[model samples]
Target: MKIFYPLIFSIFLFCYEISGQYYPSQEWERKSASSLNMSQPLLDSAINIASQNENAVNRDLRIAIIEAFSREPYFEILGETKERGGPAGLIIKDGYIVGEWGDIKHVDMTFSVAKSYLSTVAGLALDKKLIHNIDDKVYEYVWDGTFDGSHNKKITWDHLLTQSSDWSGQQFGLYDWADRSPREGEIDDWRARKLYEPGTHYKYNDVRVNVLAYSLLQVWRKPLPQVLKEKIMDPIGASTTWRWLGYHNSYVNVDGIKVQSVSGGGHFGGGIFINTLDHARFGLLFLRNGKWVEKQLISKDWVKSVQKSSKAKSDYGYLWWNNSQGSWEGVSKEVYYAAGFGGNYIIIDEANDLVIVSRWIDNSKIDDVVRLVQNSIK
Candidate 1:
């Protein structure tokens, strides 16, 4: 009897996956607030909320990076850092731009939001069997000395995606321990500290995140940006203005051809420099459960996997942030997002059929932004 029910549910899910939907193309169609059955005033107020509360980071992003990560020993911007502009964002209700503010076309650094895109690359790898399973040890594919150590060899794709890898070692002149280390620790204390069993601890370390990028590069044997372009960005009809960059020293020879490895975030500098509309497109892809119109861009299973809470961090998934842990009180646990430094976000509210991208806004006000937008729906 139990097996019969399980089979019936599986058939229902399979049918749902093949369903089609309306999606945006190169020029996204916009609808009036009233057309979408949303409160005009309330929607305007929500847009104002995001446009007004700007992030406090310096306009000269070089200074901003220094001030933010200054505590780390000898921290410097190793990747590209450029001057940033004012707040910008978009609100997509049912795949249409229902609300927007600031320069939607302006190109700017999106910090750690790149991690979500990197996570998508991993999903594609899994879909195409470039990676057999997320549970497989990374050392099996990346036999290079990078994962040679006893501790690192224990790491898996799962651990890296969740930032729980606790992967030790240096990548591109940055040490894993030195990144976001404890405020009270001395250098030697961090260096000599006992390792956490891979996947047992969660730490937001850019060095380790970069290690994931480097490992993916090894598996793909091509530049990640090219992979992203072919597999994701282009298919979704994103603009050519965006770029995924890494450190000056991050380039390595892949099969005798020198290719650059991209960074997961804009921590020490280079990450995703993207505009708002492209972000909206990326968010929409996930909001639809990886289904774009009739084409399933990525597997439905991968989309679901990115939202599940991992053991180490209940509010974090494979590079996507979750509300399940109630970290953002009053927000629905079903709402998951891709967040980056300086208030960059690609928030997905599947319940509302919405994709909200808020950049350079006060990070604290994000929940209010979400709640207000949700309230605007009639």
Candidate 2:
């Protein structure tokens, strides 16, 4: 028995060594572009391009904030927003930063990218058995009026994660129809529009996402941020500067204590406000299949499930963007990313063991940046 134990320990060490060290520390190691078989000049070019094309939205963040308000019920929800942010990006190859540009430490509103984190919290809840199955109706766990209706009761956790729930109701003082409603329709018409069965149609609605967050809070019986920090971030060595914010009205009673349900985007202004390096660490977590060093912070099966394309949306998987069309040419079709408004992205390329975090870049230029990175590889 003693001999068998020693042999197993040696094999474990061998596997760990060959697989490379996971960066389970606040500081990320840096590697030269040439060391990773990448062209340093091309990498520099990629960084420069990203810096120049900060964001297609607006160079002035205040103007962007005003525009965000104008898009309410048309392109987004009317929630809280901060008028602070600038261009920043980081490139990680084999868990090391090869190149970076702009203010890598600036905390900015990550827009819809918060949805990915929200989805991950769902995964954690599932992993801990707080919820039995993704297929189970959310109404079963959340006995609130949020899922009281027939259509809403049909909404499952999978439906919410996939943005196909068509969940009807107001949450956190935001009406369902007031979140990214069709621009062509009148407010009342859009509000009274036909409801689709859960998981049958796709709609990027923050109200529904907030509903998911609130439900998760009920199940967790604590703040979602606390759950994330305790279960994932701290274990992965993420910094404390990061914060998940929700609207002032987003509080709800859970287990006799008031818990605030966080937003999934900055659409209304309250979402994840974090730095570029923290975003990179989160991306690396997913890239490594939810493992941080020796601990599987999130289950491997959950990670795989989040990347699987939804039936309702080919290019979307549990809030993450999938490259179903293989639009990047040389990049693997398995490549998926967490994208947000104003070009914030945490791209995970499991094929290359890479995680790229780009903040406040031109949303339209994401593909170009990605392509540039791919071309740098020899």
TM-score of each: 0.93, 0.91
| CA deviation > 4 Å runs, candidate 1 | 1-20
Q: Global lDDT for candidate 1?
A: 0.90
- lDDT by residue for model 2 over 142-173, one digit each (tens)? 88687997789899999999999999887766
- At residue 1, what lDDT does model 1 achieve? 75
In the range 1-378, model 1's lDDT, one tens digit per residue, is 787998997765564334444577666878998988999888888889899999999999999999999888757789998899799999999888999999999999999999999999999999999999999999999987899889999999999999999998888888888898767557788779999999998898899989999999999999999999998888888999999999999999999999999999999999999999999999999998987766788999999999999989999999989999777767777999999989999999999899999999999989988988888888
* Model 2 ranges with Cα > 4 A deviation: 1-18, 58-63, 69-80
Q: How far off is model 2, as Cα RMSD?
A: 4.5
